[model samples]
Target: MKIPSEMSERIKELAEAISEAERVRVITHIDADGLSSAGIICSILHKEEKQFSVKAIKQLDKDNISELFSNMRSDLLILTDLGSGQADKLPKNKGVCIIDHHQPVSSEILQLNPHFFGIDGSREVSSSGLCYLVAREMGYRDLSPLAIVGAVGDNQDSRGELLGLNKEILKEAEKEGLVIVEKDIRIFGRQTRPLFKALEYTTNPYLPGISGSERGAIEFLEEIGVPLKRGDKWVRLVDLTEEEKKKVLTGLVMRIVKTGGSVESAKVLVGEVYTFPAEKGMLRDAKEYSTLLNACGRRGFPGVGIAVAMGDRNENLRKAESILDEYRREVSEAIELLQKEGLKEKGILKYFLAGDRIRDTVIGTVTSMLMGRREEVLVGMANSENGKVKVSARTTRELTNKGVNLGIALRRAAESVGGDGGGHSVAAGAKIPRGREMDLIEFLEKEIERQVNEIDG
Candidate 1:
């Protein structure tokens, strides 16, 4: 796994810029990848004895961008995991560097996005990976695990494995003995939860009747001839035999097909599972580590996530673990709400209006989980502060290949309604003024249909 020379040179230049700055101000998103990116850069800067300040935000909008320039306290500004798509809105003489993996708009600001080098920013690399490359150029290769965590958090490993620059970072982590990768059942909570609980919580492959039902998961396991317990000890996915694992996987595929899901969706169930040997409990697995970070951020404790990623395990890790429990409960409650109150359909899209019932931060995650159960694009909306609505949309990889870019569509729709939005093709988000949800949905439907029709022609 060799680094592209051009990208490597760009990373060196960014490292030089960071070294030359007297003081740095970092603004990162309030998500796992964003927090992971902040942890890497902040740790490196601290080691280098550089003065820096950091802030974690939910999104980059006009008000925050204005505040960033008005209250300037540092010689340089670094926006990680975000800001590439909003580059044009940033000031020109502010000494800004956008270290992100999202698609970039034309701007004069310095950016280290993989999209500029013909790399698939959505799938190949993430903001954390880009930041890790900068850290590597600065002689800090041991931070590879954080990069892997960020990539997994961003769902760049949707193919059940890391690819492109992410794979390159994984190789570095392997060399440092920080991460070990293997093929296994790709579900949440393999390291922390019981076997049936893990099966009940699976979402990517999204077991139809078993996913949200504890009894269903138990019955499915029993039907597959895999005992729920071995002589009084409950079975974990980690404790399954090779033959038993195959049986469970086969059962999963059959369940998906029986529920009208494509066989290709079930293929994601058995792929690379990343283990962080140096970490304990849930932190040992890359996906679970990312989930912990997400829990911290969504629970309004982004600092705790950053601290855990920066090697803090005393109070911060305990707080993060506590937050994870609460986050899971909130997520389950939100999902139950969706199940009780079905989504509204418009053309090829299905949407739900949470209207303050669901937290805006959790809407994107909730929408992603529900996407596996439907053929139409899933859109979720929740009330935000300042009388705004936050919208998160998700679609299948199959539809993305059919030229349905939710990022572009949502951006256009948001701007039409005087809002802002941008993200990957499969997942995107927006925040629009209140009383405009209907307008946004209508425009989004047209945009998605147009994209598909153009491709069909």
Candidate 2:
């Protein structure tokens, strides 16, 4: 892959920094994209024999930033997936290099994100794509597959095509013969992986209907009694077979026209079921890595996820998988509890789970899943390790059409209550001083109502 001329200078500078620095620290978001970005960097550093440590953060707060700079004591810091929004809080030292694709919030960090340079930063291109660009800039073309996997894990491949640097990376992967893109014929129903395993691994299993759960994925082969082994589990899609694959022109289609569809509806509406074959085996598949990584981020062990992505085998992968499954079960149980309690629907769908079991990591997935079920935006709040109330918000593009920017609203609301928050238009998050959770929620409700009324009026 040829490096873009525009980014050549920046990439050269970054490579020099990596080469010259004795100790380096890499921090990234904890989601699949972030983990993948970190993995790519890690792989490069590993190949170059550069000493480095990686940290996966859920949200970049003041304390974490301070601690990172204070504890790492490194000559260089490379931040990925995150740090675009918290540019102001970034270390003042000149040794930091940020590679990201999220929408830039301020002019100070605008130069750091490639999207500001006319690159697409939506699902079409992700942080991994940005990381790939950085790697290409550094002259490591072999690591492009890491970027592709990260993009896929981030759901950037959902459109069935790649755009921007994502496409460039895919082409590179194809040239390397690392990825094979063939037209898929079989119609796998909603679930694709082991339902129990996916639930255990997902941040919000309840929204699998909308977000697409591999566990319940239906497939033509499974429908015909062909047993498929995916990972360590057995899966069969009851509605698909080789004959059905020949008959069906496309994969199964699920639609969620409105919010609050059945879990089944959610599954069908959001994702396409297909079969994926790798050297390990051929099996039914779905996109669940986003939710899985979100769960890991919310739980404060994003490094484990990065390790898993790096192809960690044996005990480490199993341990990470166990932790993920346990977290998923807890979140599922919490959602069930919320439904059973029948909490009144405010302007936003919300549920509060008390006790230390609830982590800041799961809030984004839980809230996003809840919002996916309703027309209005959804917000989920939980207690964090620092005794602060962590809040997560998710809004659809439809809501954004009404001029609803949950990121701005939530950030202002959180700040008003003596907390800090910010995020994208569709999804955002914040951390508030403990005991101000309700106040923050009330403020968000008022702001959302005002925005809706203004648009309607």
Off by over 4 Å in 1: 201-205, 208-216, 257-261, 373-375
lDDT of 1 by residue, 248-274 (tens): 999999998886677766777878999
Residue lDDT tens for model 2, 1-457? 4445665566576667777887888989887788878878887787778789998877777767787778557877888887776677676667777777665665343235765566546555678777776677677776665676667555555445556677777777677766655544212222454333332333322433322334443343244334456567564333345564433222222222332444332332233332223322211232443444445565677877777556565554666656756666666666655555644456664545444545567656555544444356767777886778878777666677887877778878988998878766677788888888778878988888788788999
- For each candidate in turn, give its C-alpha RMSD to the true structure in angstroms: 2.0, 5.4
Q: Would you estimate the TM-scores of all the predictions?
A: 0.94, 0.77
- Tell how far residue 421 is off in model 2, in angstroms: 1.3
| Poorly placed runs, candidate 2 (over 4 Å) | 1-12, 107-111, 157-164, 182-235, 242-259, 262-300, 342-344, 348-357, 449-457
Overlapping backbone residue pairs in candidate 2 total 26
